[model samples]
Target: MELRVENLTVARGGVPVLEGLEFTLSPGQVLILRGPNGSGKTTLLRTLAGLQPPLTGSVSADPEQITYGAHADGLKATLSVEENLRFWASVHGLADIAPAVDGFNLRGLLERPSANLSAGQKRRLGLARLLVTGRPIWLLDEPTVSLDVASVTLFADAVRAHVAGGGSALIATHIDLGLKADTLDVGPYKADAHRPRTDGMRDAYADFDEAFS
Candidate 1:
């Protein structure tokens, strides 16, 4: 699978967040998106995921090209972990979600409501949904937010395995995830101003919050 963005410009509420950004990604490649808070990293990921409309330019994608995991856990609070996975699997046209769930070490949480899982467990469950979806390109926004050291390593291992299996990824993170990838800084892409954020989505895995907590 391949993903290409050409001269892409994205805006929110009439203000530009990313301008003239361009890149192409192929299977087995990983692109690391680096930037500070409010610098359009999240915007870029959202645009790539087709959740947000771009102001200009185009995005070309291959067949079954993208699977996106955002800062939001994307889980139903009322649903059990297995139910959530099953729901996503059905949506993505997968036959079964068990194998992926096992791969992500989520078997133990299968019976628990997503709302009852720890923060890191919730993130793993979200990622498992992507694995079952089986899209070749991954757009991950702050994937390591609430992870402990072991969980982080587990995530890194999964990422490497995915790339080796001919998948590509674009990750937005402030902390090092210990994955091998070419880094791109989106910090300079945003126009400088203290504008109030109009987008409702919050970073699910912000490191600062973990530190403060």
Candidate 2:
């Protein structure tokens, strides 16, 4: 499956940030997103992942084909690493966790509870969940946050293997992962400050004032 974005508009905190964005991510490919802090990279990914709505435009993809991993680790603190992986695997009707565990070199930490793991370890676990999802499109935001150089390489290799197997990814990160991929800089898409921005809920009820305000 492929991801197609057409004239998309996304907002943060009720303010439009990115407007008229467009792109297509086909299988066996990667697109790296580059921008300064608060550049709407995260907002764009969130819109693509269906976490929130886009103020305008569309994202076309096969249903259930996108798996997103953001800043939060999304781990169950009391669950052992192995248990966490298994839980996500089961949710996706998958029974195998070996590839993910080995891919992230997480076997040694499998028996430890997530709360007991270090920051980098937690991030690795969170990312490993993507492998078990069996979804071809990966939407990642600063995925290497707490990882060391070695771990970052491990992640880069995992992405390579994923795309080699007909998967796709949209990654937003500052550090180069040395992957052969295309880059997208969002500077040109910033929404003009004076443009009307809303969550699409406001209406002519405006002058209706305090009644629905």
Candidate 3:
């Protein structure tokens, strides 16, 4: 799958956050989007995911190619972990999602409502939705937000496995995902000329913990 964005610019409340941003994402590769607070990291991910339209430029994605996991967990608070996965799988047109559900170790929490789960558990459930979707392109925002060190490592391993299986990801995070991917900084392409200069690409994330905590 291939995702191409040309001169993409995004604006919210009449304020331009990203300008002249271009990206070409291919299968089996990962594109890491990094920037500081309010640097349009989430905006970029939203734009790419088609949740928010770009103010300028075109984003072309292959059919059924992109699946998004937003900054907030999209699971329903009223539903149990298993129900959430089953619902999402049905949405993704997957009849058998057991493999992914079991892979994420969600068995123990199967009967627990989303509201009852811990922050980390919720994040894992959201990730399990991704595996069930089986899409080639992933638009993930802060994937490790509530995960512990071990869970984070497990998530990283799952992502690596996804890439190895000929999938790709466009991750927007303030922390390091340890994915060995290319980095794209939206900070430098800011449209605000009056705003004070901030950090550069190298300063997007000092460490992965900064992105989550």
Candidate 4:
């Protein structure tokens, strides 16, 4: 499977953040997106995942084959670790949860409620959800946040295994994930100047009053 983006333009709140972005992701490959804060990395990932509409250009990929993991770990606080994985597996029509469980080393915390688990533990469970989806493409945004060194290694290993299995991943992160992948720096594509800059509350209020009045 391959994911392609051509002359893509992404915007946030009607303000363009990135433009003329182009890339293609092939099976057994990982594309790491690198950018500074507010450089539109997350917006690009969201666009690719089909969570938001692009202002222009196109993303060529089947939405059904894409599984997105946002910065927030989307686990039910009341559900146990195993229960959380089970629910997602069922939703994706998958029967086996063992691989996901083992992939993130969540076996020990299977019976613990997500609310009781630490940040890293919750992140692991959240990442495990991707495995159950059986999707060919993964879109991850800041996936390594709150993880320890060992946990980062585990996460990297999971990604390696996934790509080895002919799956593709597009990850946006600032920290190093220890994966051998092509890096795309979004600095050049930043559209910050395309939108007017506000320096302080006075400028913000002026614009607000201008629009409302």
Q: Pick the candidate with the highest lDDT.
A: 2
Where does candidate 1 clash, by residue pair? 71-204
| Model 4, runs deviating above 4 Å | 195-213
* Model 3 local distance difference test score: 0.81
lDDT of each: 0.80, 0.91, 0.81, 0.88
Q: In candidate 2, what are the lDDT values of residues 1-213, reduced to their tens digit?
A: 999999998877567889999899999999999999989999999889987777789999965999999999999999999999999999999999999999999989989999999999999999999999999999999999999999999899999999999999999999999999999899999998676645252432232234535
RMSD of each: 7.6, 4.0, 8.4, 5.8
How high is each candidate's TM-score? 0.84, 0.92, 0.86, 0.90
How would you encode candidate 1's per-residue C-alpha lDDT over 4-39 as one tens digit per residue? 999987765446777888889888998999887877
Worst 10 residues of 3 by lDDT: 200-209
Off by over 4 Å in 1: 62-64, 192-213
Model 2 residue runs over 4 Å out of place are: 198-213
**Per-residue lDDT for 51 in model 3?**
63
Q: Candidate 3's residue-wise lDDT over 49-159, tens digit each? A: 876556679998964788988878888999999899889888888888777677678888999999999989989988888888979999888888888887888778878
Whichever of 1 and 4 has more lDDT, that candidate is 4
